[model samples]
Target chain A: MIIDFHAHVGSMDSIGARLTADAMLHAMDAAGVDRCCVFNIFHADAAFGNDLTARFVAAHPDRFIGFAFVTPHYPEEMEGELARVFDHLGLQGIKIYPPYFDRTVEDAIWEPVFAFAHARKVPLISHSDGRDPLVNPNHGEPQMFVRWAEKYPDARIVLGHAGNFRSGRLSSIAAARRCANIFIEICTSWREIGSIEELVSGAGADRLLFGSDLPLMDPRIHKGRVLTAAIPETAKAQILGGNAARLLGLAA
Target chain B: MSTSDFPVFDCNAALGRRHNRRVAYDRPDDVVRFLAAAGISKALVYHPYAVPFGTMEGNRFLLDAVAGHPELVPQFVVSFAVDDPDEVRAAAEAAGVRTLRVFPKSHGYPFVDWIAGPWLEWMARERMALWVPLGRNPEVDIRDLYETARRHPDVPVVLAGAHYSNYAAVWPLLKALDHIHLDLSRFDAANGIERLERHVGLDRLLFGSDFPEVDPKPYLHYLRHCGLEENGLRAICRDNLERLIAGERAV
Candidate 1:
């Protein structure tokens, strides 16, 4: 029943900086996880599309879930990348770390990727977590997500950390109630003043997905956050994996 | 467990006389409430007021208030640059202080020099420890502490509130020394634990909260979530702190 949706198999494999395919599977077996969505770092430019992630999922089809690491900044490969990722790599969805690309969802260059994801029903998982004036401030505001939801009404774009660092902007619960299309990934932002309640009240329970920005952070901690929550079992199931299953077209 | 559930000994609360958001010990009752919520039985607290310059009022305020609050274990940072050995001895005796905390103003001169030979000798003689608070705006490099540790083999030099996980410079020096202890006073996440344990080994690491700002429940929550062995978790949560506390003069 435990499915970790966000985990990294980094460029170098170690327990901290890298959680390679084999390491992830072994850790999963040790930790009692049924499945995990494995992501890869394919260099800075996004040159190689899902090579590592695909290889891992392909090798362990029963255990691993794949997400395509696509660069919308590379405008030419939008549709081609989607087809390649979904068709060739067997990725269930697309993972776009836009801030790393220095691009935004509103960029004219990002249109084709959004369109392709919507058409094929592939979810977009990305990070919106950042804050503090001196360092990396978060790029995706809840309102920005609301705008995207309004634009791509059907596409399931998951914003990690319940759109945290953006929590600085939530000011109050009223501000949080603005976005809907954006599902919140429960991982890093599961700390103080955050939980399934905040997500449910702000963005509805269906939009909240369970994620563990694992190996970088531990899954046991992230899993415990979901497992020991004061919410209903149905809500827990939805956040943990049910919603991710539906988005990835996995049989629920 | 609630995020606010554990007993918190905030290693780094700057006492802004009238506490707003920044300081935890500003409201003594809040400290009591924080410990109660998180199941933290006790805490080792530091006051922000005396740290950079070494004032007695904030240390006095904390130690006195915490005395009534048995849950709070207060520590004073003795001045690094005492001109007189008698004053150094007097200050050490006066405060019943744990660490002669230093400020690396760089130009703060002779004071910086004071810690290495005589003051360090005095500190070692008194059996009081020397610690530098590593949390500041312009970060004090890990190398500086490593160098200081190099010069003084007999004196125990530790870095309190030293949780810079991304950096790698401090590792070798930490590994080289048997006496050096790193109070992972602000290990905000559970995931960072495995990496630290791998590098520092279990005994050298101590559990400290930059509490009130960091709720104890998150640590306890990290305890619930970390993929560490039961003994490792127990060491981090209670036993590691006990190891450090056992060495100190609870005077």
Candidate 2:
């Protein structure tokens, strides 16, 4: 099963990324993707975006796997929403956007969600681009999450986009090497040659997951990076779906 | 090993040390092997140092390194640093080089008419190809380069590493001029290839991998599945570049 661990559905206010569930399904079918673990695009209101996500997933359960969007700014109601999405709505994981809120991944505001996800054994995927000069540079730096990883040993944290920018993949690899809990997702506009190989060599094949950043980027480009990698087919299998399935506790 | 059903000629490949990163292409053989591994038939290459350091030294190394490798055609990196017009023209002619790449942003020079005026005239008179590195940096002025191409209509100006956002600007320029072309190394925006082919037509489009910094396999894979027709794919892959290269020899 080829699973895209990172994708987006619904409108984004910031950069104008809008992809409907029908559009997402068409793109997935074209790209030969079996399932997509999707989240709402970046939004200030988590509830509104999460509602769209829940409806999208509920409509196409087999094609889409939902990840609930939560923010620390809503600290008063963050945990309640997390339970409503994951427990009631049947979302599989939690997605966090730190740079959008002008906060770093290591901020204390994330402790409640982190603790909850740790206890629940759900993967926490965060937007971890090393670019974005407007925001704090450390906002998505994979190294910033090491302390959190050490604190919450059970939480499976994914650095989405693998710190998506130039030379950011190396930092993501470094972060994965430092913390066993952090896995790197390969989905970014920047496609440095041998980047996937570097991730496989620096971090194990098991610590890597395939992501398309879909609707924003094509899934085939990300998938081709793995399918044509010089690595063995077994490693490609792990990257394409096995590792992501393992992370989500699904049959590979 | 070519992924596409059609043959491809990469227009924006590079050789030698890449700036700010560890690249696989250190020697000419490395680039040749890299292209061969990707099943690419031909590539227009340059020494990465030619961007930072002036072209005189880097071009010499590039010409020598790719001497025997026909698959790797050397694209001479020239800039205003070599002020003498005769020297630049003589070096290109002696080396049998057809294409010249300029990096004003990386080489720390302004792309003004005074600096490029004589070269532009020389390129037009000689029918040489002028490859301007654009869209890699936000500060790169594609419109200014478009104006420069307007000054010398005879010279074929190829915008290497053009961003997808600049594709809109290409039509207005292309409507007036036929010498302008866009290299698709960094043009990976969603539905980018299909849209460009529809709006600008495939005749002006050229295949580019930006190798050494990026792998060619993915780009080849991308173009293969971008839903282009066989003739359109053939034009982008090989025919368009063949015309460009042939124009150089016809000079």
Candidate 3:
């Protein structure tokens, strides 16, 4: 079961120059992805937030797993907005774009959102690639992710694109062992010299999530890379679909 | 151990501080392992941190990583941190380095201003080869470099990350440099590999994987399935990188 965790399928107007929904779905079909976690493009569209994408995912529940993207920069409305997505649209997870939203993963604005997710047992994910150091110095650093996990131990946090654009080193992730809920997603780091294997070894199988930035990269190879990785089958299985399913409360 | 076959030379790898924390690529062993699994026997690795600050710190770390294991990675593209042509030659001579590479954006320096001018002159004069990455973000001013190359009439500059979208942007520039080469990194866009080969003769293009960020499998799959002539594949996949690093010291 190839559940690609990072994908966006919508109009160019919504995604601001991306594959159309049908085109994205066809691309997914061609790539042999059975299902995908859907999110909106990180942009400034007022109506194109979690609610729209979550509703889209709800319609194709079989083909898509829904994730709502929230702007943590707007701390005042984060909690209410998150509640709207999860409660009204059945969004099991929330996607955070630090670069787009211009806030570090560890900002105080996320405190309420993280608390709500922890209370609701929904997960929070970010798009970072260890590139952005401060993420948004005007806001905060990406390492502030630790504070989220540390503060809300029950809230699961996912760092996407294998933690793109300003993620810390593996050792630092290891050092922050207190945030056991923190998981890393492998989407953009397919052919990367470093890999999710290092993160899996550092954190554990339980903390790794599989994502394919699909319609952007090939999904077959995305699944193939994980399956062909030098890890045990159990870990591969977990990353492929198990972890996401269990995280989303799809199975007991 | 030809780098072109299952090549693992990562072009777009990076380094930086995050949240008052640093996610650095100063570690060499891990890099070696990374290249190895990417099925790369040798690599032309670059360091983002060292280039911007004009520090040899990351480059030296890479040198140390492949010091004893010459078989693992035999060559690297010398970063533009070395200023003096005498010193650049000296450092390459000292480290046994060859094929200098420059990151126009990561270092936040216009290639023309920083070494592109004097450096192109040196490369032309000294018969040196350089890997110039061209992309949207940092925005390679190919017009400037190509114009400079025309004036110098000798430096060998190869385009590292040229994609289908912006290849046209560099079209006017490509005319000036008889020696400028383009590698097949983002072969996904229209007129991808097959188209590029047909448009520009096979020899002008090289193969590279901007790894640890973009996957090589898709690019490899594209090339393998693109139905290029075997001669074209051989030229791109192995022959070009081999020739670029051809006369350079094996150490």
Candidate 4:
């Protein structure tokens, strides 16, 4: 029951991630992953990305769980887009990239999206980094999620990448500890040793979810991180799929 | 083949502690136990202290720490600014050290030929491998690395800690240079290992964990499932590094 909580399905030539449905399926099969929550964070046009995600989910609904991508850049259309993503496209969750939108997660423009997720009882996953020089660290800092989780207690807000580095990971753990609704998704090139154990110890294993950032990163490696962690088997089971299954409302 | 069956020899691992983060395995016994748990047979270890502190002290500490642990091979850190090249070479010979790591960015030195030429020449002559990590702030200048490796063609220069973001820069260097190799600690690009195998062949790819900073199991698992032949896996997981340490050029 390995469900990758984070992954992307569209091509972003800038990052050399020209990922397709077949490629995702091939990677998942090779890594022995049962399912993945696929989205497109690179798409500037939110509807276009959601359509692509919907198409992937339609093609392989059993294996791919579609998550809708929406940006705060289109403020007026955000509510309508959320409706289309949920009612029309039948996407399960929401994905946000604050760096791409050039807006911090704590900005006023995101209130509508957060409200929508809260109303729908759907989970929202956003890109979060800790002092990364490549992107504006404030755009998706783990600490930013604390206020959002406090504001919308019902919405499950996941800090993607768990702040990326150690400082960010520590911030993420703190954020998760502060708010039960805020979860941590572990997936980054910064494969810090003892990170999983730290996350489990700091923010209970139930709050941690497995993610690969697929088509950019490998699922095998991320899954191997959980499988080989020095934590208890029950914690590993929860982080690997049980927690994600609970979040996605899927039978584990 | 299963990942456990692969004869993994980590080429880029650090021993000793750093000030910034709490390393789980700083002691030799802890490193050995950690490696065994991760299914790693051997590791070429350097001291994490070498980057912040002087290489002389760090290298000495590393040699003494791994004295009783045969599985932990000592990889000395060297800096042209800090130590005399001739003295470093003499000590390396005395210690029978086969590999050396350099931190140009952290040590605040340019990795150009003029500053590094003497060391590179000795390394080339002795058939010793040079390890360059890309994990530092501001990173190792790709052009400087290219020039250094190009100048020292005989030295088997290993570029370690290169993440997938470095693909566009690193892939070309590997393609153009036969002596250049990649350590698979942070090279987590999707299908990256397969792509590297296709472009440069498995001979230039080496297995590494960047341990105490990174876990080894994920990398081992990645290699086991990366769709390579057993021989290719063997080359990357163990044979290539074994060859590099033994001063054998890539065939």
- lDDT winner among the candidates? 4
Give the alpha carbon lDDT tens digit for every residue of A1-252 in model 3.
656777765533321225555655655665556778878755454236666786777677788877776665456676777777778777777776666654555556666778887898887777654544343352323355777777788888776665443245453355335576877676652244336566567767766777766544445545655764678898888887788777777651
lDDT value, candidate 2, whole model = 0.78
Ranking by TM-score: 4, 2, 1, 3
**Where does model 2 exceed 4 Å of error?**
A10-23, A87-89, A129-136, A164-171, A177-180, B1-7, B18-22, B80-82, B112-118, B135-139, B150-155, B163-180, B248-251
DockQ of 1: 0.25
Cα displacement (Å) at residue B213, model 4: 0.7
Docking class of 4: medium
Please say which candidate is ahead in lDDT: 3 or 4.
4
The DockQ-based order of candidates, best leading, equals 4, 2, 1, 3
| Ranking, lDDT, top scorer first | 4, 2, 3, 1
**Candidate 2 per-residue lDDT over residues B162-222, each given as its tens digit:** 6544545654665667778878887655555655666668887888888877777877777
lDDT on C-alpha atoms for all candidate structures: 0.59, 0.78, 0.59, 0.86
Q: RMSD to the native, candidate 1?
A: 4.7
Could you give candidate 2's per-residue lDDT for residues A174-197 as a string of tens digits?
A: 889988889989987678888888
Quote the B-chain TM-score, candidate 2.
0.88
Query: How well does each candidate reproduce the native contacts, as fnat?
Result: 0.12, 0.36, 0.15, 0.68
Candidate 1 C-alpha error for residue B246, in Å: 3.5
lDDT of 1 by residue, A150-202 (tens): 56766777776655533432422232355445667777632443354556666
